[model samples]
Target: MGQQEWMTKDFYAILGVDKSADAQAIKKAYRKLARTYHPDHNAQNPQAEERFKEIGEAYAVLSDAEKRRQYDAIRAMAGGGARFSAGPGGPGGSGSFDDVFASMFGGATGRGGAGFGNGSFRFTSPGGSGGFEDVMSGLFGAGSRGGFGGFGQQPQRGGDLTSSTRLSFRQAIEGATLKLRVEGREMTVRVPAGVRDGQQLRLRGKGRQVPGGQPGDLLLTVEVAPHPVYSRSGEADLIADIPISIGEAVAGGSVEVPLLDGSSARIKIPAGTSSGMKLRLKGKGVRSSGKRRAGDLYARVRIVVPRKPSRDVTDAARRIDEAADFDPREGLTTQAGW
Candidate 1:
């Protein structure tokens, strides 16, 4: 952006935030406004599209600490409403604003260089060594080279875009490629394996395009649907709750557990296995893209007991309980004491 344009535009006002607003507050305001004015949400509305662009520009400047500071200084120095005239000293011409910068930097007041027409004037140093961008580079850091038409104006990068896609749990774990339409263009996106729900993927140079600057990126958020029998845990682990009878928990045996790929695995339950115990199956979880090993599967035990028992069954249970003589909650009082 040009210094002159920056002086005229109220970035804070555009974002509906105070000049003293913190970085988070500024970001919050920008997101809200961007969503409201986004082109996808406001088809055929030129005003909204323009507003969205303005909001993006404001955010791009305000989000960076150094850029915000420099912008504030410039606005304050130029009184927030200064305009650059098209010519040398005269009424409605290059005045105090131009003269102050020129005298301070020893820059000559002229026009037509840096591709600016006779109708527009620029504050440039002698022999085109420095212009507004050059001066800014000297003061802060280096600015955009050339000019607006000829390296005087900074290249305004296109705004980043956000979109989302839905995936089944299987697809999320195994990976899939799907097509998504963004900004009226259909793009094929690769949903990486082991991607968690609500994970965001950034696609560079896949956003709105501007004439003379770098294109923005696309922020794609993935939403994975829930599975009926399976769930996930840390990194790439898979979890499944397996139900076993009281006899199985006490004696223990092999049980058939369902796998994600329409198969089953025989898991051996150790003798006297208790409820809530987990069995780990190596190399049975979600697979990563390449080289990295797949994760493991955890089967949690849930012991089920009969709700209603016949007289004979109750008698047998009483005889077994007497023979075992085990107190399951023996240390409950002391262990749970505060």
Candidate 2:
């Protein structure tokens, strides 16, 4: 907003707050009003959207400490039956805003080339040095020369454009290239391998471009969809539960395990392997980059019990139990020390 706007608009009244309101109180009031008027919540009401924007502008000015101070000072000075103008009948006749400023701060103003000293105030503009134009430009914005870009600094880059996209679990893991439309133009983005859900990727120089300045970046957030059969651990580790029968586990045979690459691996089950035992397949998980180590695939064994058995099988099990005569829970009491 222009610096002159502060002399007219009462930001405190716009925000429905007091001049002495604390920062947190002002913020809370702004949030409450903003939510009530937000277009997302009140889409059918067009006035609500406009009111939301007004509230945002009011907050933006009042939230900054320096801007708030300047606004208050300007309001106190040029408010109530008084204004600074150039023509006759101007405050005290023929005085300008610069004259009001010169009186406020310790300075001298006259037709004798207007020398400024005894106070720290200087306005450096082409063809005009100590005038209202330079002062306003320093407070508000530089017209074309980009004066201070807000108090005499050079121009700054524009803001980043934020967007989000959804990716399948496999696409997130294996890495894929994507094409998206932004600002009426298509841009290519690369999703790296082993990227976790809710990860953010920044596309440099792909956002809003400032006039006579560098462009901003594009912050692309990713949401990975879930997979039913495969799960992840740490950076790139793949975890899967391999279900096996009690017979297969006891006999120690080779079993087929599915991989993320649309292929299956034959895993040899060691003899005496029990349920919940984990076996690692090296370099079968996610890819590594830079100083990161490659991930491994962890397969956990889960023994499945038969829901029902035939009478012949029951008879055979009884004969085998009698022949073995081994107690699996023999050391339970000793281990528990009960």
Q: Number of the top candidate by lDDT?
A: 1
lDDT of 1 by residue, 1-338 (tens): 34446667999999999999998798778767766887768998989877876776687677768768767867776774544443443433344345444544466443333333543344454354444555454344333443433444555556566665668999999999998887578878787798887566767887767777777777666668899778998887899899998678878899999998899998999989988899999999988777378999999988987889889878877887898899988999899994
Candidate 1 lDDT at 61 equals: 75
Candidate 1 regions with alpha-carbon error over 4 angstroms: 1-157, 210-215, 307-316
RMSD of each: 8.8, 11.1
Question: For model 2, how does the per-residue alpha-carbon lDDT over 21-74 read when each residue is reduced to its tens digit?
Answer: 988788777766765775657879988866765676677667667657767766
- What is the C-alpha local distance difference test score of each model? 0.72, 0.67
TM-score of each: 0.58, 0.53
Range of the 10 consecutive residues with the lowest summed lDDT in candidate 2: 110-119
Worst 10 residues of 1 by lDDT: 140-149
Task: Rate residue 95 of model 2 by lDDT.
Answer: 41
Best by TM-score: 1
Indicate the residue-level lDDT of 186 in model 1. Answer: 88
Task: Give Cα distance to truth, residue 338, candidate 1, Å.
Answer: 7.2
